[model samples]
Target: MNPATRSAFPGFAWSLSRQKTLAECPRRYAYEYYFSHNGWLADASEETKRIYRLKKLTSLEMFFGSSLHNVIQNAISNYSKSRKIPRPDDLVRLVRSSLNAAYIDSTRHYGLWFDKPSRYTMFRDVYYGDGLPPDKIEEIRSRIGACAESFPKSKTFREISGGRNVRLMELERFRTLPFADVDVVVVMDIVYRDRDTGRWVVADWKTGKESAEDRTQLALYAMYLQKLYDIPSIRDITIRNEYLATGTWREYKLEPIDVDNTLYVLERSVMEMRRYMEDIDGNVPYELEAFPLTEYTRHCERCNFKELCGR
Candidate 1:
């Protein structure tokens, strides 16, 4: 596709998240990246408008994950700059405050668009749900507190926090690697160079359950860094997923074959997305048929487009 046409669609760049969305549900992917591309136009179609609205949907789990990530990010950032970690209580307070703001924003703006509960409401339900005692709030607070406190004490944290042998990469920095015909975007949660071993360490903070996709995401980051720095081999990069919820860590070392597989997956994903968006006749409008709702009903359960799909 030409640059203009590519720019008109959502899968133009092959980020891991974009690939996952396309894999989970092409219709959802199209709604998010394709149809919604022109959603804000005054004369946009009803389908476009609907997809645009559904695209704004968020879950409590996502909010909680993002809030936790922010806390950890801030803690590390503070330590990296000042050589001091925030108190656990202060970190918990930060999480609470950030979550509260997000809750208010969701309730006031995006809550009415979806049939599901608002973020604030979901938080309350979980905090006060039946079959659980009033200590639910304390349980959550304790987990957040512990997770924050544990970060500064981790071996990896110590290595990258500040030392003569290591250099910290700015947190939340976006880097892109150009492949075949697309750019793969990756934003690492934390990355640093180990001067002693001449190795690059990349870590992503996760507050959710572990999944196979985590490996794929890390592999992509490794590939991007390799290309970005012109590293001689993928072996020089190490990937880690720091699961904050349970203070568990997963590490990965990418093989040349793994990088090959990651590239293949990305190329195939892009090809499939392009096939889904094929419009031979310039006169034809983008249709629901172009991106069909997934046959897998289970995926629709938590999908924001469930109501839109009449499920």
Candidate 2:
């Protein structure tokens, strides 16, 4: 597209989260992918603008995870220079301050966020449902505290902090994988070379409980490493999921079948996504009706657009 058209329409990009949203609810996906496009423009309809605001709503869990990720990135940079990992207590303080700031954004800065949704933060619970309960807030705090305490002491951390052999690639950075059809956007948390094992380590920090989805994420990261660094073998790379909250970690050396499976799943996801597009090459979605809502209302309960959806 030319500059004017580019400003008006968003280009297509495939992501794991985008695919997940499409699977979870087609209507929600429409609100997110199509309805919210170019919403920052002054000429956009009020509903379009509102949907854009809804798109920015961060849940408490999301906020916590983002904060932890930020700390990890900063800590990695610092360790690379100072040769010392950040103290766990310091990580706790950093998380607390960030949490406090997000709370203020949700509670006291609605007017600012309303005026500029992309600039300020608005949390889902505060907008769509009751504010976070005290116990829930306490649980978040405990989780943050645990993760902060655990991260600096993890076995993975010891290696990353070890020395010159440790080459950390793309800490919290967005790397594009030009997949077969569309550009696949991936922001992997941590990718590094193990100081001791001398193998590529693709790692992610988790502030929440483990799920099957975590493996899917690791698989994506592994593929990313394979392409980015020209990693020779799937078995050559060790993928690690560090559950900071539990002070535990899991490592997997993927087999050839794993890479094959990841390719199959990603190709299928892209194909399914394109099915909703009217002009595949032009990146135009079909009319909103083409994408139906999920049969399950349970997914809507916590969605920021629930109010707009009238679910």
Candidate 3:
């Protein structure tokens, strides 16, 4: 391992996903961010190679989430330009085509090994096997289609589409906020500002079940926005999560204390991660043993590194 690359302390960047990975399994975090940092090097260790392979793995649910997010983002972009929402059939076609191309790439180019069948293939296999049923596929399709159809009609969509009063802030772009200790990266699905009320809204698109983590994620976004724009208070920002699967919306008006608590939690988490990286002697590279596998065996079953961990 290049000590220069690996020993870059205090320059650590934090994201919600990265923090969650560390919290879920520190071993996985070390593999992802430390050991596999430069896995492409020809002289990479065997452990690095193994971790790199595990890092490249993706799940059917991830593919579906990405494709759905793309469809929605593209639809909004198109409507922003043309002021016309694509038909439900067109959206479905777009989703299926995107998934089909991803499936081909995953199987052929990446050589991703699936225990069963790819999600796209599973749609047809439902007739012959105990895989995902046809109705479930249709349900998913309908959910995405409904999200597309309803998005253009929502008040937030209208405000953003108008592009006059509530201007979209760096549509579908990831922005970073540098803190004293660590840099925080936030990729907001949609962020807009109401010119009249001088209020900013940071919106996230969710295709999965809501979790408490969602609140923390949004709180961080709101806090970041406050710092990024030099806003006087958290009350000036509203964080929203749009659940595409059910077309339900949840909004949070963060209080000053919320942002304070979020910052405390974030700093504490980063310090803990930093402690994991500290190596007093050169013998224990990455302190891999310190980061143990999760005690929850159920998480191991779905982990991409399951085989590597010999679970």
Candidate 4:
């Protein structure tokens, strides 16, 4: 991976920052939000180093995601032109460039370590272990290379249009809402508006093990659409985790009423938080001490105030 020339979506305003901090650690939020303090980790610990390395790799994955998204987005845009979807080369180039940018960022962030054998050794041990032999590694590498071979044909694109990217219109209310202050926000990897059926469908490309919880998450997104956007035409929400390891796609879809009920739960959670905030003094000292280690592992894992919290 290479370094990023700039941060992703610079100047993107985020109300989720407070929620992100709180999710990381209430003490961290209290310190940063109330005290204006920035020293969160007191310099990088061993875990911090590990996290930073993982982040660089994650940045590379982000590039891959962006590449795939651009390819698919462009295909959607050009559906009217040439009666054909964009080629994979267009997206593959973007992915490679994005990966280069990731490398650049990692080089800057980790210095010489980005190129060090020690780093590679650590990454492979952590991410790959001994699961891959040399030939298998090469084979997998070739498949990734083949990702650039060709774009989806028109017929193929048409078939997949039902489960491709859905543009996310980030709503301010969604960000600042009492209960539904989403920690991370992303639109469905695929959303199709079926003109013939008069229905909207949502899908996400996933690359992990599936669980009932994953289906619930997709259902939750559907709930968001109905409650926040009032797009009552959404008939199905699907979660598909395509496993790269096994080359299999696992899918689950949500019923409309089930999604609606999920929205009801979200509404109640937000209303409760709203009521709680009404009685709280904004100027009062942030009571981080009330947060305990048993509450969440993230506090110990990421909070700069971990030492103080433990004290």
Q: Candidate 2 regions off by >4 Å?
A: 1-3, 170-172, 195-197
State the local distance difference test value for candidate 2: 0.84
- lDDT per residue as tens, model 3, 92-115: 788878767755655454333322
Model 2 agreement with the true structure over 27-76: per-residue lDDT tens digits: 89988988898777777789889888889998899988998899888998
RMSD to true structure for each model, in Å: 5.3, 1.9, 5.1, 9.5
Ranking by lDDT: 2, 1, 3, 4
Residues 142-209, candidate 4: write the lDDT tens digits. 54445444235222243454354433332332332223443324345554444454445554443224
Best by lDDT: 2
TM-score, candidate number 4: 0.50
**TM-score list, all predictions:** 0.81, 0.94, 0.81, 0.50
- Lowest lDDT block of 10, candidate 2: 1-10
Model 1, runs deviating above 4 Å: 1-11, 40-47, 108-143, 162-164, 279-286
- Per-residue lDDT over 1-311 for candidate 1, one digit per residue giving the tens place of the 0 to 100 score: 34344444443566878888888888887666667665544465777666665665555566666787777777777887788856777877888887677556554534442333222333323222332234754566666776777666665786775565898876446767788777778878888898888989998887667998999999988887887778998998999988766778889899999988988998888777667655522212267666778888788866766656676
Residue 215, candidate 1: alpha-carbon lDDT: 94
Q: Candidate 1: minimum summed lDDT over ten consecutive residues — where?
A: 124-133
> Order of candidates by TM-score, top first?
2, 3, 1, 4
Global Cα lDDT for candidate 1: 0.70
> On a 0 to 100 scale, what is the lDDT of residue 69 in model 2?
90
TM-score winner: 2
